[model samples]
Target: MPETSLVTARERAVALLGGEPDDATLRRYLHGIPGVDAVGLEQRAAGLGTRSIKTSSKAWALDRIISLIDLTTLEGADTPGKVRSLVAKAVNPDPADATTPRVAAVCVYGDMVPYAVEALGDAHGDPDAGGVSVAAVATAFPSGRASLEIKLADTAEAVAAGADEIDMVIDRGAFLAGRYGLVFDQIAAVKQACLRPDGTSASLKVILETGELVTYDNVRRASWLSILAGGDFIKTSTGKVQPAATLPVTLLMLEVVRDWHLLTGQRIGVKPAGGIRASKDAVKYLVTVAETVGEEWLQPHLFRFGASSLLNDVLLQRQKLRTGHYSGADYVTID
Candidate 1:
């Protein structure tokens, strides 16, 4: 939109939020955005899923999917050895095939950041630099029930431990209770906490846990709230929730990102985490990104898939494409 257009979605957003928004301003801004068209969104997402990828395109998609994965291991039993293994996978992905592209990052809990960083060594820096990044889950991941002080501390510790990115979960309870201000403040504060002792800050990915969000409209609101609060990426889940990362939910988020770009010329990242285990399913999400927000978002900086078993499936599919048949279980690692 033209800067001088006077009336745009962003301008409306600014006006709704006011200067330092109170509860009324928060509700007004969040509730003011266009409500989701549930049926239309779902049908469009399904249509995108059915779109075909030819042989050559499928090969390219397979590699692109590999590059876009945030190979994750977020469990209570997570060990340093497991994190190193995850890092090794992120750095190599398929050891037999040297040509196989490395993944974007290895996501682990905050305490494991050091191990992930240690294992990555010099190969851990920037994803765009042909290196793997270490992402840490913080802010009471998948729960977001802790105090703001604790949440900020969680993010700070991850950044201090050399995490390249911080995936912080928002408080679904507060969001569901219509406490938009509380959620907004928490996100904004966490974003600040991502800043390092040095000038550079770790990129913050806000997890909405869309499964608990209940409605598409709620997802839309949470996406906007995350961006407006300075989130580097709006994520769909923490991999602990059910019904995570559906095509329709991801499509809705991409639409919001598309609109944000059009309105303000700012491109925000989107991540669909969990429940996406198949190569075919991952390809569908790739198609959705291209169709919804354009192929520019196909890059690692703009899109990511959070999954533990997803890389295994992508690797198996890659081997099949090369040898014309599925490989044995040994071809991929067990997460």
Candidate 2:
């Protein structure tokens, strides 16, 4: 907390919380940082989502950006009715707005993948008929406080159940306790368990629970660690806590992703989960990806929103443009 030792305090805080600070801790530190007032975080968010670069390779990057938008929702105990309702809303979307880019995947918890897969079959009638990939939250969700054997089994089950991607949370307690190598190995083992039926692997999104990790520095460090350990995507939160995904934390992640891409030449993804509720907020995130990571990450593969109530607003905005008037709120269901 000392001015001359902010850096040291940050290191100590990261150490105190175990090697990986969760979102709650990270947000506290972010708010406590001198000169990073509420407005500063918002300003940082505004700036991080708006950069675009023109290059001879711009067209190629644009295609990559288009592929990175994952529209996600992982409710605690979804039923077939709920899955049907969600799938209907996702696939039909706004008939008046059929041309908008579809999300990369529909993320749900493990129990719902079968329902999702069935719904996709009923509606779209083909493996890829549904407009999104089936992403599952596995390996001891919200709280990564499970044993390794159970965690690996969870990962294997989800992939076997047809999850195209796996979002696994790191064991915060261990990471915060300076067991960096252990956390890294945990991620590696889980990633290995997410292999596809063809022996290829499902893409792995390691949720740092940035809020828990507690600092931009740790978030950055975790970003590098996850990538080094083979994370296909570095997500911001589990949507389990108060500060589950905020603009400032996301900017830090994007900056890390951008730099990592440069250093490793291996493209990684970014997903900001929790508390995003409006189309404007979604666009703000898109803007942040474009500006900070460049246009390369604008797509769902590189970018996504882990939200339950966001799609309605996106549909609302799209419908407003089509009908020249706002539809009654009662008509919206993705909420």
Candidate 3:
């Protein structure tokens, strides 16, 4: 389809959900989604994982991986000083090498958005000017066990505090209990709460928490549910749960986003957070994206790795590529 037609289709999809959808309407929409083939899905992801990327291509992939990182720090003990340090590292990932590109954004809890924004300075205003964006994890994050009113308020506070992006978690209980309408409504409500006072809202990334979903079929369903609810991006995990961001899970998400774009002409991003700590692992994800979704999704806006230590490993690999030798842990700053 033509690009213009694709855009129109996506716009129409969003417009169609302008009003509150009834339970029956949501059920019919969800039930209409095709089932996933677990064996086939696993095979495809495993096959892609074995593909080789070498030399110059590897270097290019490493750099691209750095740019796609959402240098994250979501801990109960998080402080302004720690956030500032993280922001500094994000702005200049490779302090020794000025040629290295900055990370896409710094992801923190809602309360830390102001500190991150302040520390980031002009980069927050103009990401193209070597600046980074601030993403806040809200909506009873990691676990959507709160009331809808509280969740919406959490999202609104983040956006109001200068968060350029909001990463929200869906109520897995509602989803598992076949409460598709409730899940859809919660996501739509959060999306609405993302809207800023100036009419420019933070981009919404709905985290499906695939590990808890138990099956590939559920992951596929959750992906479609988020898309239909107007999520700008569909994420795999919150990084708090075990078995986060696995190759097969991320691969499935990539496929979903690819299919969603083809069907709607509106491109949605994918983020594989948690457990992706190595440079090699990050490259494998890049390979999967290039092969599954094409190079267009290679940019930071369309792809992001939700990680903290992953940045250090990427920097080390970059140094090795430039110097033909390995660098020590001391070389990179600790997040």
My TM-score estimates for the predictions, one after another, are 0.92, 0.76, 0.90
Residues 195-267, candidate 1: write the lDDT tens digits: 6665577888899999999999999999988877777799999888898899999999999999988976778
| Candidate closest to the true structure, highest lDDT | 1
Give candidate 2 regions above 4 Å deviation.
1-43, 46-73, 95-101, 122-130, 326-335
Predicted candidate 2 versus true structure: per-residue lDDT over 111-169, tens digit per residue = 78887777766343221333567788988898988999999998888878877788999
lDDT for each of the candidates? 0.84, 0.66, 0.82
* Ranking of models by TM-score: 1, 3, 2
Candidate 1 regions off by >4 Å?
1-16, 326-335
The lDDT ranking, best first, is: 1, 3, 2
lDDT of 3 by residue, 121-184 (tens): 8778534345698999999998888999999899998888899899999999989988887887
Predicted structure 1, TM vs. truth: 0.92
- On TM-score, the leading prediction is 1
Number of the candidate with higher TM-score, 1 or 3: 1
Could you tell me the TM-score of candidate 2?
0.76
